[model samples]
Target: MIKHYCGIFGIYNHVEAARMAYFGLYALQHRGQESAGIVTWDGQKLREHRGMGLVPDVFNERHLGKELKGNIAVGHIRYSTTGASLIRNAQPFLVRFKGMEIAIAHNGNLTNTVELRDELERKGSIFQTSIDSEVFVHLIAHNMNGKTVEEAVMAACKRVKGAYSLIILANDKLIAMRDPHGMRPLALGRLAGSPVLASETCAFDLMEAEFIRPLDPGEMLVIEGNSVKSYSLLDEGKKPPTRQCIFELVYFARPDSIVFGEDVYQCRKEMGRQLAIESAPDVDFIMPFPDSGIYCAVGFAQQSGLPYEHAMIRNHYVGRTFIQPSQDMRDFGVQVKINPVKSMIRGKRICIVDDSIVRGTTIRTRVKKLRELGAKEVHFRVSCPPIKHPCFYGIDFSSKGELIAANHSISEIERFIGLDSLHYLSIDGLLRSVSHPEKYCLACFNGDYPIPCAGGGCSRACLEVTD
Candidate 1:
């Protein structure tokens, strides 16, 4: 599975701001699971609740109603892309500087973190956590002298490069900003006449908020006293080209979301349709590996005029911290996560549809189980092209060494995964499935990173693919 770094949600001018932010983060739980936090700004002070676990595990009725009383709130769910998983790295990182209390929740990775961290440390700027998100707080603080939070934010943004969809709670105002490349998703909404912000529109549905629109690349909006004002991060007479993360549509986003001004379900369904057009393997029935692959499998089944079956049953009750079986059990985790329906799989030629293959090991184990179940043939269809590159701007395949396709050919992957055939939606097919395809960051598939990262790129193994 490709793990996204984080998800953020914020609300301003609401009586139950923290509660609403909790629900917003709950809806965005799929984006991260390592940690969860919420910060609330009362008229006179800031309150916080952060813990290392799922939203429900971290927060309760008591935390929301009693501890986090405020009219403004910012929430974060983190999966740790730039820092180790620790309580200290949990966010809606709250800090007090110069009589102003500020809290920030971030939703993307920064490429120049090392340089900025070095510079800050040299200037005696102490860091409390190793997460790159802290750099924003320090930068904003450094610029806070003789400047409004807006000016500080703009100045801080100007110095940093890469993906960020940030929500800041500074005193009584809630601020939202997106990177110039728009490498992450952030949506604007209205709830009960209060302005709200989230990493995806799906949160709006949960909060009963009206989906206003997506925040544009380089756009910053300041929400104060039920009013919103927009500002551009771009220099005058310059509009940066949009290079939104395509992986959000492919896997990171919920199917119910509207990201980058497009419907995620429709895009995934179209990708499945396109995959069928390009590589429709002859099969008796189509199946998905459960939740992740269900929508795409539906599209494949519809396009191929084949039967759609729930051949694999997912154990929804499986907890994130399930007790590990002894090493002797081997594929115990995978087996418990999902089990093939014996009746549906025996003597069948099945086509399994999925979003994308990351490491290929888990799928290989699942396919091996299918063989044990007496399957005639197993064909795999991927809705997106092989992820051949690392992503520095958020979705966590940070090392080319971790990507199977980055080191091996299509046939090699097919053999390794024990499939009769493995086909991926071509790059053109993926583009055809979405609107304004030119605006997407296809860096994971093409290695054309919009903002270069010093510590990220193709590894020697990726370079060896063509050689």
Candidate 2:
């Protein structure tokens, strides 16, 4: 039940830009469920429609076909990490500066939000939303200084720190950029000869767009009327190492997605294979927690020569339980979303495979349910290493205190979850499972943050800057 950060989509010079963006946002709906939005430009004026709900609930045929008429557009699906869950913070944030209108959709948290906001506020710049994403718009607007919009965007990027994948819609151009560390994913694609961008390739798949490639760290592309101009913000030989969030493959992204140029499903399967090789427990059968755990469990079962079964069924309609904001709500959501099959669980030594354990509440509750359903023994297996540090980038894992592994020993966690035994993929094992392991950020598991938070601590207040 890990909370995803956000998803962004943009298209340039497409006649059905708003409709295509709707489909793209629909494909990326799994990334965020708190709110959805889209802003379009019809060569003369900007049109916008946003709401605090799922994609289908927010946009309809009328809004896409008429109200949001445009040949260029940007869309967003948000699970707030930097702001409170309010409609005002729903992104594709549109603003007017010097008689020019611009819209931006962002997919990461800013580490220097507090510092930047303070500096701006002191200089008579009024703020809009509490979200750190609004900082980007302000920075771009104030830094224009006779420079082109693309140049202003790059200049603004230099003033910020931490993970960000951006899709910006100006009056005449659509722009996309990735952070210097590439901590978040942004992909370039094409649909009917028009340039498009999204947080993941899964969106491209849904729209029948061809993925060109993932944007390099610190790279910006200004797309105008099917022509794209690329620029690199980093100086020669001064580029920082790429540190894409490894959790994207383990949990955040769709299994069918190609994130950071690697297949997510294959990576999870490799993780499961590595888990089997490193921590194979004696069990009658392997059962995945459902959905996220299915592919990993298959790999584990295959590697261990054990049968795999769906002991728990998931309700697809229910949103992710981990992002429910409260322990009581998360616990309740888990119960309503997943139910154990009594016939499959009775009198069995079952290994329950899951992606990762954050607070341990959801897994603990599910384990209790299994035991109540007559499971003789529940051995818990995690495909990823223990999350031992808070994520300041985009993930909702905000405090070290919220991470069970950061506070308790493995055996203690096993006892707390009421499992017969528990095993998590080792850090080294998890690293070996991915391509270009050195290019990944594993701070949540190892406490080696690729980018340090502002004021030198990973506290929620320091990273998020909600004020």
Candidate 3:
């Protein structure tokens, strides 16, 4: 498991549904960057093509337009949690099962997968992926004996635990479901006559789809023929308290998206303001790392009465260089991904706002660029608190040792990132940014995991892997 395990998107009843799904996947590409895939349904057939690159790299007219068909389509970008990080684990895992052609795209990791998988093995079910998600099919196969697909889904979900937001294709109906705790984000969108479902609302914004509210905690959704039905999976007293990940606002979700009724952009702004209050940095200008840090930087600059500037401009076309699996790739990745705007920050006492420092490799490189560009002083302002624990719900914080903040204090991190000062937003302020401040999860930042961490390492509790 890495960080966040890719985003899932689907579009229905549109002329260019596949392309729309591609755009949706593009908006959510941050969730997972390992690989990307899309599956579309023509009235009579299913068409899909995927590869080991970004969404644009995987899809094009020659490859996407001709091979992809259908009014309904599902898309996924992979960030494998427990299984092999290979083409096979790259989802939307499509298979013909139970006399129905099913394509399943999932976000989040399932606990109790091993037990469920052993049960399927006992029933003669052959395995495919190392993903906990694939165990879901086996659960449905072995446990779903109900009359309708919805009933079968409800039946299968009853057996599982931990965070999961999923979309299942069963012939005519497209089903989307979220774990009772709602650990991951899933939203339903509408475009003209089409109905869509995405891991984030940013997908809807990309296609001009009207953003709909998040699926209720413990809600089951069935989308078919441009309409949707929702039902709660738990009784009133049995509800799992809502714990949407706080990192979504700080790092994961696109700024344009809304989750749990909070605007990601606004939430980030609030985070920066809080970071300002937490760190109370003495600086000349508030600067952002660009892309993810813009919103938080805005809050920092406004609250601190410091001007905000882009000290570094990211080359969007560049592949995620640090995401490379090898040393050559990693070094080359940092080499190619960013270009410092020296003129914008040649000589300033800068307080740079960022989301969080994971491995600290990327931020260290970024700070080096700022220092090299002749900045007199560079201070790091992180919008979220220090991350000491790995995430098990869905994100791939696989190892505690890899985290810079896990073993070091703010002063130590300042030395590592080569900053004159380093400040992180307080956990309390981060929670305050959410629209419903009390409802979201802050396990990664605070180490107070709402759900169980399962075990120490990623192999046994595989989804917790963070590096």
Candidate 4:
């Protein structure tokens, strides 16, 4: 599985704000797993609790129902994309300056983090964490001389350039903003007339909130009580074309969520349909590796008139971290994660459909297992085009060297993975499955980066951070 970035949720003027934020974060747990935090603004003061673990592990009834009492609350779930994974880097990063308190939960990576950090350090701004997100706090604080929180945030947005979906709790006001390019996903919702914000619509589903539309590119909303005020983070002439991350639909977001006005499940299913139309091999049955490939494989089965079966049963209890056995154990890790259904695989020509193959190692091991299970032929089909380039805007993609597709040919990858035959969805087929294809970022597939970085993803070498 790919590494996740972060997820943010906020609600204003709600009686159970912290509890609601907790549920929102729980729905968005897929977006981050390293740490979870929540900060609230009670009438007199701000209270916060942060811990390094899943949402349920970090928060209990005592922490949510009693300690975090407030009408306004902001929460964060983090898997570090910029800094090291440390408890100190846990978010809803709250700070007090000039008697004004502001807490921020950021969802995307900034491109110019190194440059901005240097400038801020020279100006005598002491940094508390080694994260790029902290740069936003410093920038907002620096611009808070005689301006409102919204104004300070807009000024800060102008100085930095990159993808960011932000939820900020400033004193009694709850504010939300998205970068001009719309490189990340953030949606606005409402629950019993109380305004709320989250990284995905799935959070609204869990909170039983009404999904109001997604925030427009570069739009900023400041909410207090039940009233909401909106503003643009950038001037009209300065706004660039929208470059929404397509990977959000391809892999990052949950199928139940609505992202960028598209139903994620339908989008992925259509991708499978397009793949079947482009290339459908003759096989006894089609199956997925479970979870990630399940939806796409369904569409492929329907379009190809092929029977679908669950060839591999995933061990639902498998945790992200597991104990290892001796090197003498063959394929112990893969076997524990998923075991082949030998009754369904004996002498069958099986076609496996997956989302995307990042590194060929994992798929290679699984394919070898299928052969040992008495499968006649193992053919692989991918629903998305080959990922030939690294992603710079938030996604923690492997470098060119590690990305199998970036350095190997289609035939080479097929041989390396021990597949009888392999095929990937064409770029044209992938674009056909989504709306406004021109507006989506295909940089990872086509190598046409919308925003230039320091090369090999966001350069973190200059920053004094360790992972």
Candidate 5:
């Protein structure tokens, strides 16, 4: 199972900005399920509603109508790449400093969080949340000495590293920025005449907004009243190479969304087609792991000329099992979330197509269950290459010890997962499936981190302790 990073949304100069943000968060619910939050600015003051759960569970008509009213707002859904999972860490993190009220919603992790946090703490700055996003607020506040909010934001951006796609709301303006590497996605849109921004185009679709374009790496925009202005954080002729996270196409973003200016569904389908060409296993029919795997399975079936069917049914109501805090709970949730169709697979040789395999436990359980349901033979095909390195730029697979591929060979993994055969798409195949492969960060598959991680390790301590 794979974990999702956070999603962020913001709107400026809309009558129902808070309500619109609520819907935007609903559309991005797939990106994060642990918590949801929305903060609004009403010209003079800020109002917000934050809670731990899915979007619908967190906000309702009463909360949206009574508590949040503004023309500018920002929303966030979190999955905890940094800090513990708690209410205090829930975002659209609101803070009051020097008589200015500001709210920030972030969608990626920072590599310099500990260093910045320590520096601020030593100067007597009190932190309200454990998440690295709070460091942005502190950094901006410290740099606000007779400077415009945009200037302060630029200063803060210069001080931080790693992946960050941010939506910052101040009393007068709404600011949006992406990291220099572009390791996360952030797009601009228009709702009626108001400016809108979100982590994916799917959010714009849900709100009936027209997508303008994706924010460039190291680009920052300031929106106020009905006007939008753009700025560059990087000095002229010093722009770093853009390295958008490749995994966003592989699994994170919704299939219906357009991320980094590419169609996610078509990309996944192409990956499936490539996988079929690379590893064509002889099987009776192709079966997907449900939802995320469905499109790839279709592409594989089309390419391999094999029958496709839904052999395993997924529970739409069940939240992602990977988000469960403990391994035991995650193992239990996986069983409850999917059930095999006994009659269809009673005596069939099935090929299972999934996005990627992380720990190997979930897939192992799935293969074992299929056999118990009387499957004659089970073959596994993964759309992406094995994840051999931990991701430090927002993905939750941050510990190398948790990745089975990091420790075992492909044949060993196949035997451990109880599969007749197992094959994964090569890195070259995955790159060919996308429009601009050179712009993607493939550190999870090949240890080529576009942005260097703190302490050169994959742990919470490593993120907090700088060399």
Candidate 6:
């Protein structure tokens, strides 16, 4: 699978606004963990605090609630794309531009970010984060023409390109926008009669908020002073970008969240069922890689009529930076990440379910561990199709030759991972699983990018020109 960026979220127009936005972002913490941030507007100004940590660890009932009180607010939990990881890169990017400071939190990658940044820098724009989102502020600073922040936002949108789902906070307004092509996910909601905005409808469900339509793929929705309006920014020069990033269904989003009115959990479950129907394994119990595969495992279990086992129990306490020091350290991290429920796995024929295989280092290691732990048989099942190319949009991976499954056939992969058998969901079956299938861009799996690649795939000229 191509490495994907983190999720983004925000809430607006509620009493105890900042605290409420915190909870909304808290529900979305699974989307991104590199950093978290929140900015609240208390009539006169915006109060902001963001740092690296999980939601609860970064925000608290005492300080987070008291210090961030406002009638309007926006928040973010960021994972970097097109920038190095560091404190300065953590988002909810705030900048003073054209006489007003606006904060922006972004979810998708900007294919043309390098070009935008260069143009802005040549004009004397100084940037704080290595993050691509900083370019939006610079572009806005240079182009804002309206007396109000909303007008400035509209002006800025005209100059920017590529995939973006943004939550932009102005002094008196919260403007949520999606690229005209709708390459990423963004939604609007309402709770207690106040309008709200979030990256997913699932957050709205968590708040018992009524779900509204997603921001039109290229439409901008402005929430200001308790009123809302919409604007179409489509340029005749460009067709809407069609790549919606199929990774969202396979790995990026929390299964509980909904993207573009489609339930993420349901999409994965359906993928598992379709996999079972097509691959029909000669195994006993089905197992899943902890966390991501839980729902798919359930679908596999129900479809195959085999019991699901917690063969590997994951440790919840291990931090992201917990790199093991040796094979023993690696094994120990595996033990911490998941330990075999010995009784459930011992001497049984088993099927393992996972979202996708990237490097295969983790899989090769894990499959061997299962054998050491006494699994009689191990058959592997992947929910998504093989990843043959690297993602160029905003995710970190770009070397096509490095993907384990890209060069290896199923039997070759089975031998490489040391699995008794292996299978992957067909690309067609994978597409059939998502709601509004026609709307998504499955380019990574299918190599069918909806828009022109600025010039062409992997060309330095294209990369430099578009980015």
TM-score of each prediction: 0.97, 0.96, 0.90, 0.97, 0.95, 0.92
In terms of lDDT, the poorest run of 10 residues in model 2 is 319-328
Candidate 5 residue-wise lDDT, 351-375, digit = tens: 9999999999888988988888899
Candidate 2 lDDT tens digits, 1-467: 57876999998888999999999999999899989999999878889999988999999999999899988899999886555788898888999887689999999888888889999889888987888888998899888889888889988998998889999988988889999999999999999898889999999999899999999989999888647989998878989999999999999899999999999999999999889998888889999988889988988988999888988888877653345547655556666788888899889999988888999988888898888888899998999998988888888888888899999999999999999999999989898988898999988888888888677865666655532
Task: Compose the digit string of candidate 4's lDDT tens values, residues 81-187.
Answer: 54478998999899998888999999887777888888999999999888778899999999999998889999999888778899999999989999999989999
Pairs clashing in candidate 2?
Answer: none
TM-score, predicted candidate 2 vs. hidden true structure: 0.96
Model 1 weakest lDDT span, ten residues long? 458-467
> After TM-score superposition, what is the CA distance of residue 302 in candidate 3 from its true location, in Å?
0.9
- In terms of lDDT, which candidate is stronger, 4 or 6? 4
Cα deviation of 348, candidate 6, in Å: 2.1
Error of model 4, residue 220, in angstroms: 0.6
- Predictions in order: lDDT: 0.89, 0.88, 0.78, 0.88, 0.88, 0.76
Candidate 6's residue-wise lDDT over 325-355, tens digit each? 6755656655667767778777889999988
**Clashing pairs counted in every model:** 0, 0, 15, 0, 0, 7
**Candidate 1 structure, TM-score to reference:** 0.97
Instruction: Report how far off residue 62 is in candidate 6 (Å).
Output: 4.8
Looking at model 1, the pairs that clash are: none
Best by lDDT: 1
Off by over 4 Å in 4: 454-457, 460-467
